[model samples]
Target: MVGNNHIRSVKNVRVKGIACAVPAHVAEVTSLTDAFGAENLNKIRSSTGVERRHVVSSECSSDLCVAAAERLISDLNIDRSTIDTLIFVSQTHDFTLPATACILQERLNLPMHAAAFDIALGCSGYTYGLWVAGSLLSGGGSQRALLLVGDTISKIVSPADRSVAALFGDAGSATILEHDPSAPDMPFVMGTDGRGAKNLIVPSGGFRDRHGQSTETSEPGVRGPYDLYMNGAEIFAFTLARVPALVKALHEANTASGKEIDHYVFHQANRFMLEHLVKRMKLPPEKVVLDVKDVGNTSCASIPLALSLHQNKAGSHLSGRFMLAGFGVGYSWAGCIADFDNVWVSSLTVTSNSETEGEM
Candidate 1:
């Protein structure tokens, strides 16, 4: 007996498998204090729930993507040969010539038919990536897609910037997208604004300007350098406005189910940001799920990381209507809900502070 909400569209998709990877190098706020000077580190830790974050070990975004992908493959015992599509989303790629997906395809050893490519976006990349995979799976364009969100924002960050440098960390998260082929909520909404592009960007390196050598550098409407920059205040203000509106719009617009949603996962930008967003959305604290306090912010990887952790950490207790919201970097954003019926989502330990780090 499927409930009214559970009945869904004859087509709402279920999340099949999710895996997230953090670099082995873990740091405590104190350690950060030691690295960046205790006075400055103190100011950072006091506000954000994050006590520590993972920094990639001598690897670029591709390496981190593969780390998460391996876990997804292992967890599902998925045949590497059958992955029909691979979408690697990241703002940071190893080089200009090869797509990050190509590097991933070779490393993951997938079938050549697997359409591998990179969708370069920032934080919104996860939600946007979901639409790509879901549409392909549901339409039978492909049976499955390895949706990988990877970023090493730390590499390009200016340590002196202080705004995003201390707040973001490097990591990868992957999900195996298979079709419901039956009851998926195929409709999705995505939005972007180039007007806010300067608010968050790595200003250089692209074929558009002939790989950083172009007249654009001397011209107007151009960026400065190939380094990461974020206006934290602007991002926060924008997210606060847009996220709640999108969530409510999706909730009202949903025809798939009538059940009240169970969980809400946001982009995990920071503790305060999420807290404010949750309140503005008027969700009870329990319904809002997050654990990004420790891992800093993993840019495109945030939402999937939340999903991977909450899947297991929340256990059998977390089955029902749930919504996912991702925003940032493009000034782009997206929102969607999933009916996780008859599905078992795995979990992992994702405390902001591990045993030695003390309280959250």
Candidate 2:
């Protein structure tokens, strides 16, 4: 028997560093007006609060993750060999056969003894990654781990699909977690509802559906099963239904543990959905971090990217207790409370074609 409301805690796991990378290309919302119509595009901009997004054509999500990990390792002066675990979380992996984590471990030059794997999660990934990595670090001996997460969602999403075109972008992030007995305990709550999986998914290209055999390709406005498809209305309703409850539950748990949240970093789904969640939960607007305007939704990278971008502007670490909630795709969601005091936060890095290499 499994529980829907799962709670876990890990002690003495400190976030040592966080770095994010995105494609150099910027696509402004106004630029899409010619295709989506000026009036309709305006409405989208107003609703999603996205003005521009970083996109990549030739690059894969692994490329972005490798760039971010390299920057983090270089900036923090961390010994690559000490990283005992590497977790790569994303939906847009470089290949379907070998796990992207294995490729990343090699590209990043981790020790052969290091553990590596991939997690197929989208928006809820960062918080989940943090939990998984932190838990592994909490044990004795394995002192450090790299949790890399992101997605090149722009490639999978159809350019002609108005529902998700301007809503997503490409980016990757790396978070360094290490053992620190003095660090505060991190608490989290995670839940999933598979009933809503169909509301947002890429119906093909997987073993379950396979590729080049979808029936929806001929349908009006359908971009075949290989392309990303989203039922925005259903996702919106699902968020409205799940996010507030998750927030409230997590908030109560935090309160019970005598932890007062100093900031809320919800997944950068869109401005409208985030604002609604904040309002519904009666959380203070000042405490909520809404930095998605320029980056759009970078899937798993959004939360960490938001933190990185904020620190880049403020020129300081994200101090105090912060509540993070990520909900979307997988119909999966996770919420957590952690303190990032003195954590090394890097400014956003732009991806280049030369950064990607052919072999490890």
Candidate 3:
């Protein structure tokens, strides 16, 4: 059931570079002790493994993504005119009318001929973006693609809500995928179940519930209809039931091709959940990346952000057969086994606006 019609393989596409950026503002989880009490805050911190996270005051997800894209374009010395495809993936877009990708294309100085569009997704968006971009390139229409993924979940979460406020952060990333004749094929497995839609969603703000918005606390100190509501138990159960199968299908497909995965970089959902997955799958702990201590679950930006952070911390480039999986937020899950050969991953950049503030 996991691999019948959901598996896809794209060839002649290679990732050229990746860059990530976060806001300059930092929010400590323990600073909420007055709202949730010391014991509750401690419990949340220990379980989620989130000590602090970067947040945005006036900046949106697009701002952070533009900062990252600017850095990536500069670092790789990529010609702006050569990028013919622009894919911006996120749940929080700049506007509901004009696509944010169009604005990004103009801001990044990409050619007007570039095909720009937006993908409304979260958590599994990075892998999904890669799939779409790779397909576009491999199909012969596009030669180079720029995929931007990010989310500012903090803007949606109620500050007083302990369930989500302490578990989410803001981040953005840009990844370049170009056509390469000698690059190995990238196999991907993706699945989705809309039954778990309400389990993690904003109850209002869309067309279905446009007039149902409310800022009043729905529960005592909890979120409202317009805010993000996550049924944690349901999400955990869904991940347990779905993600393992997704990973299994990806592994089987890769192994059939006589290739082994060198690293596992899953969506940095949380510390406890990632640790549990690693143990249950019997994967090598050293090969898996579990770095959610500083930046909390960043939705779509998590995967690319993790790769950039890992490469910077190791003080070297990432070159290997990498297995990247992203699961959550839509009850959507995707995993890909790709060969990364000296992929250019820039160091983590922190920004307040257009200029780099510092590194976190």
Candidate 4:
């Protein structure tokens, strides 16, 4: 039997604002024709709908996230001391020894009494972060929380590897969650299937394989064991098998509450995959957000990044019932149905590599 697919709701928590940041260095698909060939590059662009991606040089995921957090705090005019909790969610953290969230607390100038930590998750991280932050506020202690999510996935992907090189970009996002007695419940459905872990993973670099040096011969354009390895077929199959059930559960919960989802924002894995999901689920294309053409797949940051970009392009604040889902990496998946009322979404900001150096 499938477990961990039930919907749980958190009450008395509301999102205040969201902001996203990307590196200033843009890498166009056309510039990669030399590595992937003209014909192959054209096919990639057509299938993935990715023309260009913002990349980072000498920048960590924390840098982008910090920039986004600063923008969000400034836009919202939030007092740093009022933020009682900080959660940094990302697979690409600044350092392995010290949790990036701890450093971020000091960098963002959050109060020392605030609870801070990190969640080392990838694609499903943003939803997971929201679930945790909302739950924290609902239980009564933290009045405000900062949910920072993003990934510099380009750092792990080999430039010559066509599988993911042209399909991923670097990005970070910050979301403010506050406790409000009048807010509606946020329902979430989350699950994990470890069986498909190896299908999308880096073979080494962790404690399991410290050096990341293996005797096995590497693929043509692939780097050593530290680089990302993705079995596209398995990932597609996993999504087809698992995500529909997740969405269905959320839909049922929303319907039971006498509401309907106004928008569906799934993780921006790729254009083809998203289009396939839209068709399979019989969802209205107009209500779905597909903004990955310029930014590519941003892993944990995709959902909020898409939301910010969509709202900016529309030149209006996003309000109403929304369904957000994130699946992939660790074979994990999560979906949330929430009611947002004129929430603040900042325009996408561009940060340079030098900004991350030294103190904030």
Candidate 5:
């Protein structure tokens, strides 16, 4: 059932506006030394390169996503009624039954004809979201689509587990996809490995193991069944074993079609692994984008967050032909190359409202 080579090509769809929103609270990595020994803290910081992360106390993923989408719509002056599709990608949804996309449709005030749904995914979600949104708009009926991606991972990771607590952060990002015949053809490659699902997962709370009993112990550094469990070593090994080859395959396909990638953006997982990937692929470090230092790993929001945060930095490639990759979580990964010609890339917007009242 795992498709390791699923390539998709979509036409007449172009990325329009990009925006990101993060919680106001700052959680510095050094502050965690008190909770998790100083030695362990330093080792993590050195390897992860996460100096700070934005975490929310009471805010939910829906709140952050709505904030980001509203800003993107307003900043771009987009006609709300014209949008015909809305897709929300996240693992942390508001409810188990009603899809968060339906809630967003009402909150965003889209037209009655608009179709909305949710995609439950994590780190690899942004690229997948882009592909889905673009494909939906390319169907000739829907002219515009909104992709909202993020996760309030802080709410899932056990506060006692330093592994996840020190690495994960919360962020919501918005990307607009519109129909444009003149736009470049977007080429994509996606894959999945179900065998590694347990390597990074929350084992309980789902119907798979109902009973509601505690599956994890109170080990100081270890996580329990109710907490986020990540086998860092396995993840690193998978990243090294899979990501480079995935990038190479996608690059060859894009280049073969006469496309020149001016920049590259990979999922902001961490520093050590990213550096190793770059070296293994033998790609020039200057072309690769890395912005995880300040925001930590924002899951699906990492790519869009990096695009929004580093737009002003020198050599930042928010335009031209760019290769984008998102990996991890569900043991899934996806890559694509697209042109941002005539697209409006917005600056990063930080919102601190923290209001979870279901309205802005």
Candidate 6:
């Protein structure tokens, strides 16, 4: 269940193509008027260093996934029929009935024989999805798989819920992974704490509550209409308690590879969480890639989107190893710091004629 290494070994599978999509509706944080106000926006801006964010309009998570996947498949010039499997990971799903992967498979015109399904994960979903696809390829379970992640928080979010709205943006990313002989099982370290599940979640609007009418309520406390809720303090405590240990483990993985991790691309949660982790880990500021400028916190898409954009922008400096870590929602989290010195990611650019949320 492994390939040697993307960097340490000469036989790493290259990340041939990557594509990301965001909805048409975009507004800078400064666009927030008296509702959020420039003051609140400035505070978030100061903390997250984000200027703008994207939102999905009249679209569900599956719609964005379908659209994004189509764009990715076309742009990469991949024969959709060749995708042996489709793996989608996201906390926000399409409908409760059908798996979003199957829905996307139909949308992409891939062969029905090409297995498709979904993984219910949060921010770390992108990293977890890669490792899942990689393991399948290595174990001879599937040849090449498409991994897609998208969020529709723009619709789910209660405008009154300032906490989540200020940070999250809606987007999806797709990666095309093919089998390579020498790559190792991308060092996977994942965990969960059911005890903290309630810290970040939508308390209603599920099978559990489909019949149970949501009790009317308002915020400053538990509110109804049951929007995405988060106890920022609890989440911080949970992440602070968990991620550093994983960071240390990542360091160990890098040391054994004869190469220090040159960069760390963690989830684009927020700046407070990021700064705290960076200082505690003693990692260089440059090593912590901050791709959270315009897109804010894009949930499952954050890490891959970060990788997609940073690798595109960094150009020749893209070599060297980097750590990928994501923590949030599900009270579940995961980390994978791989040796990718030999990996070359094709830069993804969204053009005016492209099939992105805006252009389309």
User: Would you give me the overall lDDT of model 5?
Assistant: 0.84
Give each model's whole-structure lDDT.
0.71, 0.85, 0.89, 0.90, 0.84, 0.72
**Model 6 worst lDDT run, 10 consecutive residues:** 1-10
Error of 3 at 104 (Å): 0.7
lDDT of 1 at 179: 62
Q: For candidate 4, write residues 129-186 as lDDT tens digits.
A: 9999999999778899999999999999998888888999999999999999899999
Which tens-of-lDDT digit does each residue in 1-360 have in candidate 5? 123565688889988888788887889989888788999999999999999998988878888888888878887899999888999999999888799999999998999899999999998999999989988878677799999998999888887787788898899988889998888788888889999897888877788755546555335456666678888999998888788777877777786667667778999999998999999899889889898888999999999888777674643235678889999989999888888764565555566765423211
lDDT per residue as tens, model 3, 255-344: 777767889999999988999999999999999998888899999999999998889977646799999999987889888998988898
Instruction: Name the runs in model 2 displaced over 4 angstroms.
Output: 1-4, 216-218, 356-360
Worst ten-residue run, lDDT, model 2?
A: 351-360
TM-score winner: 3
**What value does the lDDT take at residue 157 in candidate 4?**
92
The list of candidate 3 runs beyond 4 A from truth reads: 1-5, 213-217
Error of 6 at 210 (Å): 1.7
Question: Which candidate, 3 or 4, would have the higher TM-score against the true structure?
Answer: 3
lDDT of 6 by residue, 198-314 (tens): 778776778767653655333654345457877889999988888888777666655666766778999989877898889988889987988777788889888877876787666
Distance from true location, Cα of 121 in model 3, Å: 0.5
Residue 357 displacement (Å), model 2: 16
Clashing pairs in 6: 3-182, 3-183, 3-184, 4-182, 4-183, 4-184, 7-341
RMSD (Cα, Å) for all candidates, in order, is: 6.2, 3.2, 1.7, 2.7, 3.2, 4.4
Clashing pairs in 4: none
Candidate 4: residue 292 lDDT (0-100): 84
TM-score of 3: 0.97
Q: Of the candidates numbered 1 and 6, which has the greater lDDT value?
A: 6
Candidates 1 and 5, the one with greater lDDT: 5
**Model 6 spans with C-alpha error above 4 angstroms:** 1-14, 211-223, 316-318, 341-360
lDDT of 2 at 257: 65
